[model samples]
Target chain A: MPIYEKHDYPLVDVRRYLEPGPVVLLSSAHNGETDIMTMGWHMMMEFTPALVGCIISPANHSHELVRASGECVINVPTLELANQMVDIGNSTGTRIDKFKEFGLTPQKGTVVSAPMIGECFASFECKLANGKMIDEMGFFVWKVIKAHVDKTVTAPKTLHYRGGGEFMVAGDSLDLSARFKPEML
Target chain B: MPIYEKHDYPLVDVRRYLEPGPVVLLSSAHNGETDIMTMGWHMMMEFTPALVGCIISPANHSHELVRASGECVINVPTLELANQMVDIGNSTGTRIDKFKEFGLTPQKGTVVSAPMIGECFASFECKLANGKMIDEMGFFVWKVIKAHVDKTVTAPKTLHYRGGGEFMVAGDSLDLSARFKPEML
Candidate 1:
């Protein structure tokens, strides 16, 4: 007999488990003001041109900034930044500058006005691909224009946010390349 | 010294490491024909309405089916289904029935025309929310109408697709719920 007893469960809090990802810091700037918000709800939408989609509720300060400027930088931090990510994510950027408070230096990006977090292992400068659905769905599609990474750490430990302040770090690198098509790789 | 070094890397392949998530089977049906495609590029866009977004390249057979049918099912499978997930992903559905060829059992969903894979641990019946950007971005936004999970395997082993055919299974569950606000959780 199969060990799985599948059934419909309460959808109320299941998202806490369904939303799996490494937390990243999203930096946005508009009208001479800049802010950083730790975000986990995001996804890669396309391979070539590297389109990305994320939800930033209007309630967030970064939402208006990103909408007005039409750009943002996605900074992928390592596991070491987990606690700080949580701290930044939980706090609001309404009154204070997260960069100064969190001790993260902001560096200018190649294509977008948003600054990249100097402390992050990698950063993707993105230009908004589509913002029409922001009002209805809170969805923002970004096309990555420039990318950067810290190559020294070939085996980088990235942090995946599990709801309720818990996180899962990238563990092992398994090779299944032989099984996939070259185009997919 | 922080030991973290940052540098500009090629933009082409960073997504291979940056996009992280568990492998899922995306099911779509149109005109009485059903098809399944393995996907890793997906994200939770909202909480209350349970919105999800994924990319289905126009090249993929399910793209038109999902667009025309206006619905699809996001089936979360366990690690045991990794090989099959990969096999289905590597092949096309233009000429063959993936369900019969792969020996997967399909069950009817509650709110959507897309059938749920019986073997999966969890399934989310989703209706296409927005398709205006499908032609330009190949992005499909879906609202999850019903969700089902296998309760027996409380600690279900889910597979995360690592680029180049590699996969990562979720590890330990850490509880940081105490630190987060109730609303955010």
Candidate 2:
């Protein structure tokens, strides 16, 4: 993963990123070929068994690999890796090895054959929840087996894509007005 | 719901809003009042049966509610409600009337008593799965009874939280790359 400094853009564009959330970077290798792409239509639907819902467009190469291998890695890419993300998001893995094309490194996963990004601050190795595809109408659901983040990386500042040509960097915490509640009544 | 123009800045913080990628959002009702809050740690374990894993933080009122009512609604909020998201995220329903305080509305659910967000685009009413909810050590699992997104609306944006004063908005489609696949080397 490429590294970059922290950012401080205005709060306007940032809300789009926060409410809709980040476009997650996913990678998978099936039949010896690896692919990467950006997706944001994902949600952790459950907690105990660790379930996730990721909407696949039914056309991306990653969708094919995920269907075949039954697993993939959900990696959180920081803004430092912005250009790489755009490149990975736009390119197909059927022709080139995304890991090598984008200079990303891969590591074996603890639970599944799918590999994790050695550089990403956080990553999850997940297997598909079978028969859960929404009949070509909804997102793909997956079961997460293992997840990790770099220990030394103090704060993981990541990139998020909003509607069109808009991106936001994760920012610092701002406490709510302490009196906002007390004054409400 | 406070409807706004396409790009209005409502002064709400996104991180303070409910986040996606499940942890737990407990459903609780006290003295005939009900509310839900974020469960930051969750997993999507299986696809067959469409199950999800979520952890209920001991501190949330909804945790107690989930156990008592045996059901809850997974309300997916959008970037349009980021400011309100923060308001609900930081404050607890234990003391405040979240819906009233925020001027929001709730609707009856199809499968579970857990109320659904009347305004948000997507809502899932779920039933309790047996033998789920990892020991106090992990999280709880739910058997989804019904998942609904406003069919009238198309191309809706989703939200993502990286934790701590940060968020990302999901964007529109990026058609799968038309780049051709090559022969195996």
Give me the displacement of residue A7 in model 1, in angstroms.
48
Across residues B83-118, which tens digit of lDDT does each residue of candidate 1 receive?
778888888748578889888887888778888888
Q: Supply every candidate's count of residue pairs whose N, Cα or C atoms clash at under 3 angstroms.
A: 2, 40
User: Which stretches of candidate 1 lie above 4 Å from their native place?
Assistant: A1-20, B1-20
List lDDT for all candidates, in order: 0.71, 0.56
| Residue lDDT tens for model 2, B1-185 | 63322221121211112222412234445447688675444433344455555556556667666767767777666656666766666686456777787776777665676677665665666666743333433345666666665545443454455444454444433322232222200
Worst ten-residue run, lDDT, model 1 chain A? A1-10
* Highest TM-score against the true fold, candidate: 1
Off by over 4 Å in 2: A1-20, A175-185, B1-185
TM-score of each model, in listed order: 0.83, 0.53
State each model's TM-score restricted to chain B.
Answer: 0.85, 0.74
